[model samples]
Target: SFLSIAIGQETPYKAVVVTDGHQALETVTHVLVDLLLLDYTLPTMNGIELYDQLHAMPGLEATPAIIFTASLVKHQDVIEQRKIIGLGKPIELDELLSTIERLIA
Candidate 1:
């Protein structure tokens, strides 16, 4: 649904989400090399971990990602890491909207 809509859109936009960590990584590495990713923290592999993996990749060194999590305790550390953004969960529409605006901008 979302992936299809994202790919089909006339604008320069595309997205994909896979709940499994291994699959997500593989998909990104293979199926979707050109995409900028926004992954949720509570996922099977955890968003921070995924971000780190992607960040280390040769072509992905400058790629952007947003991490959505339910825990504020981990927020400061992620922000301190300096390449990722943390969005707290319950996933409010306005908050998500704001984060997306900031991310895409």
Candidate 2:
């Protein structure tokens, strides 16, 4: 993916791809994630719902996240409520890398 390529070029960051929310949940429980890049549409649970679950996990409340979606509808309220960054789908590589850099820094 673009993220893997971009992040690879700029830093030594490793990307972990999860197929669904359940896998994401399991991964989070076992890993120490610095930042989260979540798709708004996921099987079983949506990004916001997954974020809620992650936030409720011990020691993850302040983890920075970026939620991306292809849909036109914007969940401004939920984004604000969760204090997470949101990105539109077909994410620009530069924008994604910049956001990731900012969040990780």
Candidate 3:
């Protein structure tokens, strides 16, 4: 949680954390998310797979998402293919806040 705490302090939006991609999928099924901040190395299914699935769902195809990773070398192609914003790990709080604000705006 550092990101959640930081986000809470910086914005009115609440951060809902899910342990893995499957949980994320389940959560999204029941909730309408304004933005998605996904880690690339998620358990069960990776971020890209989860993103693809989410995008397939009605009303979510255009949802803005930020995919973060500690290692991006292996995921660059998929990230570009998805046309989603990718952020390197140890993401700056300012940048994250700004990105979220922009996406949700």
Candidate 4:
């Protein structure tokens, strides 16, 4: 739901949406290797765990990720430990944009 709006706003470029963390992991082999990886995922493997894996890979450590989750309260330990920008659910447009701009800037 939220990703669609973000991709639309950033369009004229390509967009690939992976529905699950497992699929995302698999796609990383074929799709992510060719692009700049920007992640926003929840639970399952969680963002930081996925990011940690990506960082250890040869060419992905420097890639940036924005951790979007509905479980902020539950995952405070993981979020804080990783220094991730937690974009909470309910999607506040301004805050999301500000975080993205700050990250990309």
Query: Which candidate should be chosen as best, given TM-score against the real structure?
Result: 3
Global local distance difference test of model 3: 0.88
The digit string of per-residue lDDT tens for model 1 on 1-104 reads 55335444633555665666777768766764544445555446666677777777777777666665677565668655756666666555566545555666
Candidates in order, TM-scores: namely 0.68, 0.90, 0.92, 0.66
**lDDT score, candidate 2:** 0.86
Estimate, for each residue in 27-79, the C-alpha lDDT of model 3 and write its tens digit: 99898898989998887988888999998988899999999988776778889
lDDT of 2 at 48: 91
Output candidate 3 Cα RMSD: 1.2
* Clash number for each model: 0, 0, 0, 0
What is the Cα-based lDDT of residue 73 in candidate 1?
63
* lDDT of every predicted structure (CA atoms): 0.60, 0.86, 0.88, 0.62
Off by over 4 Å in 2: none
Regions of candidate 1 where Cα sits further than 4 Å from its true position: 1-12, 31-44
Best by lDDT: 3
Superposed by TM-score, candidate 4 places the C-alpha of residue 85 at a distance from the truth, in angstroms, of 0.8
